[model samples]
Target: MNQQTNSEAKEFGSLLLDVGVYLLSSGASCSRIRITMRRLAIAYNYSPHISIAPKSISLALNDEADNALFSGMRTTPAQGVNFKTISGISRLSWNASENDLSVQQVRDELSRLIALPHYPRLVILLFVSVAGSAFCFTFGGTLLEMIITFGATFCGLFMRQEAIKHKFNPYICVYIGALVASLFAGAFVKAGLNINFEHAFATSVLYLIPGVPLINCFTDLIDGNILNGVVRGINALMFALAIALGLLSAMLIYNLK
Candidate 1:
C-alpha cells in the first residue's frame, strides 16, 4: 500500500508540473501559474514549489515524509492567448480543490478540458476586422477610409495567420502583418480611394499591438514577479519595434512619407 501510494503521489506531481507548463505556454502570468500550481498541489495533499520564467517552468513536490518526491521542468515556446484554456484550467484547479478527486480522475477532467475547441478561425477573423474598423472610426476616418481599413485589416490578419501557420518567427509574423496593413492603406490613398491618410494609416495596424503582453507585464511587476515581468515587458517592446519597422518600411516603399 505504501508503494502504491508513493507511485500515485509521483504521478500526481508530474501531472501538476505538466499543468504549470501548459499554463505558462498558454500565456498565463507568472503569478497566476504559481498560484494555480500551489492550489492544485494543496488539493492533492502535496506541497508544491513552482518557479516560472519567460520560457520555462519548474515544479518540485514534497510528500508527507518531506522528501523531494518529484521534480519536473519543461520549456515551452511562446503561444498566443487562449482565455478559454486559462479559464478552464482555473475552474479545474478550483474543482479539484473542492471535490477531492483522485489523481486519475483529475487527469481525465484535465484532458477533457484541454480538448475543448477554440473559436473557429473565421470567427476570429471577423472579430479582428470589426475591431480594426472600430478603431478607424474612432480615429476620425471617413466612411470610405473605415471600410478600407476593415478590408485591409481582414486581409492583413489572414497573412499573419498564414505566416504563423507556416512556422515563421512571431516577430516576423507581426512585421508582415503590419506591412500588409500599411501597404493596403497606402494603396487606397494613392489610388484616391480615400484622402484622410492619417486615420487610415494609424488604425490599419492597431490590431497588431501587443496589448496582452503589456498588460501582463504590469500585472507581473505589481505582483512582485520582477524577472518574469521584465521578460514580458521586453517582449512587448520588441513586438512594438517590429511593428514600427514594418510600418516605416511600408511608408518608404510606397512613398507615403
Candidate 2:
C-alpha cells in the first residue's frame, strides 16, 4: 500500500473505466463489458469489479495483496453500433492477457482502435439504400417500388447522418429520418406510381430500426443485468415510437388510408 503502488492502482482503474465506457457506448452487451474488463484487470495483476448501467460504467481496481484500491466511473459516450471496434477491443484484451502487456501498451492499442476510420459515407449510403431496396423486393414489391425505395432510403439515411453529425437529439434524428423516408415513399404512393407502394414505404425506413439495441436488451435481461436491460428496452421502444410518429405524420400529410 505504498504511495506509488496506490497511485498505479488508481491509474489502472481509470484505464479500466475508459475501456468499459467505450465498450458499453459502442453497443457491447453488459455481460461482454464485464468479461472484457475482468480479463484485462487480471492480466495486469489486479482484481476488478464493475457496474455497467445504460449510461455509465463504474470500475474498481484492487491489488492482488488487497493493500491498495482504486475506483472510477465514466459516463458513456453517445450510443452507437460499431462491431469492428468491439471485435478489435476484444482481440486486444486477449493479446494483452496472453502477452502480459503493460497498461500503457494496452492504452496505445485502444487509442489506435478508436482512431480507426469507418467506411466512407457514400459507400454506407449506397449499400444501405440497396439493402432497403432488396427488402422491398423481398416483400414482393415491383421493380418501380424497389427503385422508389432506394431513393427514399438513401435520402432518409443521409438526413439521419447529417443530424447525427450536428449532434441532434438521437430520438429526433430517428424521427427525422423516418419522416423523410416515409414522406418520399408516400409521395409516390399518392401519385399512383407503383402498385405495391406500401411495401416500399414500409421497407424504406427499415434502416432506422434499432436492431442492435433491441438485441442487446434481450441479451442483458437473459444475463441478469435487469437494470441495463430495462433501460435499453425503453430506449429501443422510444426509437420505435419515433418511427411510428414520423410515418404517421407522413400518412396524414399524404392522406393515405
Candidate 3:
C-alpha cells in the first residue's frame, strides 16, 4: 500500500465520520444515521464500522486495496434537523453510490448541501404559534382559549429564540419559554379573558415539549438500541421537568393556584 493511497483512505474515512456525526446531532434517528453512513462507505468500496452514542460517534474504515485501516471519532454538536438539510445529505449519499464519485467530488457536493439555508426565524415562530393553537383546539379548547394560547406560544417561542441567539444553555432557554408562556396565560385570566383558563395555560406551554426526543426514545427502544433509548428518554424527562418547574413558578407568582 503506497503512503498516498493510505492517506487518501484516512481522509475519506474522516469525512465519512463527519457526515454521520452531523446527521446524528441534527436529530436524525440513530438507525438512519448508521444506515446512511454505512451505505456511503459501501459506495466508496470501504469496510465501515460505526458506533453511535448520545453525544458522539466513532467510525473505522478499512481499505481493501491498500490493506490500510483508518479510524476517527467526532463529538456531535447540539443541532436540530432542518428537513431540507437532511434531505440534501440523503441525496448526496445516493449520488455517491450511483455515480461512484471520488472522495474529493463527494466532499464538494457535501459542502454545497451543508450550505443550504434554514427556515427564517419569522416562519418558525408563525408555524409554532399555529401548532400551539391546533393543540389547544384538539384538546377541546374554546376559540378564546386558542387565541390566548397562540399569543402565549408565540411569545414563549420568541423568548426561546432570543435565548438561543444569546447562546444561553438550552435547558435554560426551555425554562424561560415555559415561564413566559405560563405567565401570559395567567395574565389573560387575571384580565378576565373569556377563555378556559386551565386549558389555555396547559396548551400555551405545549410548544416547548421535546417532541422529537420523545419520539426518538420510542424509536430507539423498538429498534433495540436500548442504551440510546434510555438516554433519550431521560433527556426528554429533564425537559419536561424544567417546563413544569417554570410553569409552577409562574402560576404561584401570579396567584393562579
RMSD, each candidate, Å? 1.6, 1.1, 1.5
By TM-score, how accurate is candidate 2? 0.97
* Candidate 3: stretches off by over 4 Å: 65-68
Cα miss at 253, model 3 (Å)?
Answer: 0.9
Instruction: Sum up the clashes in candidate 3.
Output: 0
Local lDDT at 7 for model 3:
87
lDDT of 2: 0.89
Q: For residues 122-162, could you state the per-residue lDDT of candidate 2 as single tens digits?
A: 99999999999999989988888889999999999999999
TM-score of every prediction relative to native: 0.95, 0.97, 0.95
Clashes of 1: 0
The whole-model lDDT of each prediction reads 0.86, 0.89, 0.86
Q: Per-residue lDDT tens digits of candidate 1, residues 1-257?
A: 36776677778877887788778777888888888989999877788878887888888888756777778778874567777778988998998899888778878887887778878999988899999999998887778888888988998899999999998989999999999999898888888763788888889899999988899999999999999999999999999998999889989998877
After superposition, the stretches of candidate 1 with alpha carbons farther than 4 Å from their true spots are none
Judge candidate 3 against the unseen true structure and give its global Cα lDDT, from 0 to 1: 0.86
Worst window of 10 by summed lDDT in candidate 2: 59-68
